[model samples]
Target: MACLLAVAAGYWVLGRGTPRPTGTWAMGALLGSFAVAFASYAPLVADGLEAIVPHVARLLSNCASLAAATSVLAISFQLNLDPVEARRRIRLRLALFAASAIGMTLLFAYEYMTHRSEQVFALYLLLFVSYLGFAVVDFLLQAVRQSRTTRRSSVRLGLRMAALGCVFALVYVAYKLTHVVSAGLNLHLVPEHSQCTSLVAVPCVFSVTCPALAVLLICLGLTLPAVVYPLSQARRRRWEVASFDALGPLWRDLSNAVPEIVLSPVDSDRGSSADADFMLQRRVIEISDGILALTPYRCRTVQRTAQSLTAADTEEAAAAVEATVVKAALAASKAGQFADEVAPPSAEAASRKDLRGETEWLLLVAAAYARVGDTGQLETVGA
Candidate 1:
């Protein structure tokens, strides 16, 4: 499941030019190798039908390992070398893997190889593991080195996770090498767990389980950067959209009350289109402008009623007070008292450092202002 998910995310990253590095495809290759291995495994294949032609699966797996190893090398080292040298090295490695895979396939298809225990199979296994293992270790060193120079937090985190994954891969290498030695040299490092299969066995757990964990860790490392970052960005965009929605009613009401106060006057034929941030900033400005224009119309009755409620100075409490004052002022404006005056009830301009704080204060005021016509009094919010 993880390998499949990593494949999706890694491919998406590759398509978008994300992470700005070859590592994205490398991550996909790591996941792809696991996916191919799983696909080839009899248990995972369609009803285990591949059990009849198991050698074919082995050939595919061999190629996958080589591809994964080359990808790992490409990602681990920075692309700072000469282009011609890089191309030559890549082509040479690819040819090597292709030749090995073809030769192995022919050997298996012919009847020279009967089972996985043969010397040739052991040799192939060792070579496959050695390439991937070397890449894993080299990747760890290069990633750690890059981490020191990497200034971005996300990138640093990705490199560290990848390094940790390499540690698991190295452990898998150790287990595999031990198995190869036991199989090819007829040497058993681990005692037969007190007993073995009537004929043969050595630490039954290491064969399949250990490598499974290594692949899982590698997939997880691949997923972090590819999946987490895009999700976080999506969440942020959603928040911006929600904020815009919450402020919609306030903007509409205020625009109706004092249409002239709007910063960019809308034309009848073509409406002004804007982005979330721009709309938010513009709405705030329009609301402030409307309040400024209605300053001289503050209702003394509303002020007295609000003062009787509370004197708290916290943000919420302050908003309540401000809401009542705006509500009263809106009423006074509608009733035509000082609605057309040039002077304000005060000389001070309200200012706050936080954008959210300002938005909250204005939203509370807008809500109360909306309610004033129906209630005919400042709603005793705090009281």
Candidate 2:
């Protein structure tokens, strides 16, 4: 119980950044698992609680397992590249899981109520093994197929965790099968009755160990998100950094040239329309790049600027462009824009049509330059 609680807490902490839907479902499943396990062992803690608690615990465990399985399917759907394709796949998988779980539940209930024999228990064990085995095989095949086609680290990590979870399920099934088969053989190998059999088992072995194994499997399944989530976040951060770094030099040159071109008003400037266009393009790129490069720390600002830029038209656009650039520059310099909030950027500027794309590229470079205090390069360009 202590280990289970610890694992659940860890999951909650690690899952803080996950989408609300996924995190909520996963946490609910974890709590359900814990409730079931706690109820199962309530008998040990208090004899009076055993009769009612054990039965309730069994039912809850089954329900929790089903819920967890469904949640996993939902997460898989959410992670799919194409929503339509993902929905189709998830629907099929969920249907299959529901069918299997229902069948297994009916089989176990019937066997428990009718025969109440060790054979009935053995059959239940077999059902568990068969169901989980099928699930494992299907998931493994899907993982392999996804690995071949997608470069997404999250997808790969999710698949690997799913595989590991299936393996744990397999182990639990195997352990249950061994105990069921041993009991049916009438071999009193468990030593209390001392009957002869091929297996030399000690007394209370299954009674003492099987529940622990089940708990272990539950814990393993509950803790996987903690392992996979951090890696996914780190990978995403690194990708953003790399993308921004790629646009550094271009942004430096453009920022430096902008003041010169705008302030000097020379005949050369008329001929430099192409240069102006290029600089405008670079500005758009920079904003886009910055949007992508900046972490969650600047998300709201970036989003606001992006929305403003997208909505403005040509004449009004230049003001929006300048404002966004200034805001981004200030942000890069660790001087936040909140203190000097300007009117939103216009979407009508020469670069506003595709401003989102351009700004993203520029932002990355600006952020890098801002970090290193390399605006001197811009002066050199102006000179």
Candidate 3:
């Protein structure tokens, strides 16, 4: 659970902006959860010094729980209520959690003085569990209601996971409440020989497993949306950047072959979509112009040979054929073999409806150009 919380904290801190102060509250909850995990487990280490001061450990655990509850309440209020009402309720919840913490501390100290009496410990447990119940229930309700209000799939899914986590937390609270009430009031509310009292079977589930599952689910809820949105944008940006770069060799070769086709200067900064799109658009235009300039050098026989060599009608095969024709055309132009009666070589540009489609088509051609452009195969095939 501590590991999960720590990872969630990193996501909230490093990932693109999270929703306002909820991120702050989430950080607090993560920290408090870490502290609680430490307090609970640190003494179990056989040689640990914390075991010598067990009362201090209990105090730390109590304080950690208080912090976690208060932060969760703050998150719940903001997610479920209007801004003004959220602020008002935040104050109220803070006071409630603080009072509960103080009561638990006093009871803990009293129980320590009484040599850890079961009754006094029961009172402490009851106080903590009551407020914890309230906090978890509120968080559950808020997450469910807020999930319904959002249309974003990520946010809705995250909130539902959080609400499910709260269900586990409520189970822990209810079990603790029952145990404490029976201990403090000397009443047998739970049936005798119940599985809950089984030292081997159910105690670990009620105590450790439930809380751990709840913490895991809540951590996922806190980080999922933060991760999903940025990841999607990054995926798209990476593909566009790769495609833009892939057109480099073809664009450079064409510009060199037809210097007059060059237009405005290229921008060195293509870190953003606007810059990349503009550069891509310019490159497309220049390549088109270069193709037009070489039209007179195009050979109908070379186009037919290139098509026969690449028989498939797939886009890749078409791109290979186009690349072959371009290479042969460039060679003819350089060798002063221009023929005005080639009748456009019978090869036409692939039909595209938009800039993105044009770019994709060109990407296929550019990739094939690197394979067949300077391989001397164009000469053998077009000879």
Candidate 4:
């Protein structure tokens, strides 16, 4: 999960083209810092390595909290302010965090040198927990407010999820604050129990559960907006590809009969990486143009004859009549038999005003053309 968060952070921080006042970079820093800091919390020292690991973990704990506080401030101001004002605000936040971080480190070192004195330890914990609490609460409020007003559905959902994660983080903060108060003031709020049973205690349980849930929810939220658009585009592209292929047979027959109608020639490899929408629209126009070019050879007697043969009012029946007429016209043009000029009406009817409607009607016509074996039967009627 930590690795996942780190990866998400990298994707957002590095994958973008330009910086916007969206706090995206700060959010990435927050995720990356949080993951690294949390993963370092567990001491990995062997007997001889004790001098290093514990010290590094303690250092990271304080520094991570400081970084998170700075990140929260950066994010909040960036969203609401102009770049110059936001930069000014972030600079002040960084200065404050830096000062407090130095103080916290000094206090920790003193406490450690004093044989881990309870008084100094309590003071250190108090300072650390207070800053962490402030950061978490600020982030929670920002997330809630933005989630409500953000228009993009994926972004809104992500903000809401992140806000919920911040709620769990607040729980974790409260638990640590309770520990600090109990230890420093000699308050006996937390019961003394064995380590195993203590794990079931309210504070202990929250301390374990809240951070894990927070990380999971926050990571998922941060990544959703990044992934949704590409996935949706891929889905749309697939449908366009299928529709383009479905028009294949009809396109081939018409283009073969009137090759001049094709403005830009398409190849078998047209589907490799070209824009699907553009390709589909081009094919629709070419098919329409092919029908117009064949009008000189369209016999009125053939259209009437084809209509009589398939006179049902259903969409498929209508398509069949049109397909039969196209087949007969193509044959007449090939045989050097030109009919008297009569303005073609089928071209206008087939090409609807809207692209979507045109594509649907043309798909039906293509299907009918594929189903009919030959124009031999329809040609006899025209002759």
Output the lDDT of residue 161, model 3: 93
Residue pairs in clash, model 1:
none
**TM-score of every prediction relative to native:** 0.56, 0.45, 0.58, 0.63
Deviation from truth (RMSD, Å), model 1: 7.8
- Estimate, for each residue in 71-120, the C-alpha lDDT of model 2 and write its tens digit: 44445555544778767866776686677667667766776577556666
lDDT digits (tens) for residues 136-210 of candidate 4: 787788788888888888878987887888888888888778878876887855654324245456656776568
Candidate 4, lDDT over the whole model: 0.72
lDDT of each: 0.60, 0.47, 0.72, 0.72
| Stretch of 10 with least lDDT, candidate 1 | 340-349
**Model 2 whole-model lDDT (C-alpha atoms):** 0.47
Query: On residues 43-145, what C-alpha lDDT tens digit does candidate 3 reach at each position?
Result: 3632253557555665666567667766776766775678899899988988998899888888887887888787997888888888888888888887888
State in Å the error of residue 274, model 1.
10
Model 1, 86-195: lDDT tens digits are 66766665676666666656655653345555466557667667666766776688778877887656667877877777776676688778766765676865443243
- Arranged by TM-score, best first: 4, 3, 1, 2
Q: Which ranges of candidate 1 are over 4 A from the true structure?
A: 1-31, 43-63, 69-130, 137-167, 180-186, 190-205, 220-242, 256-258, 265-278, 288-314, 328-378
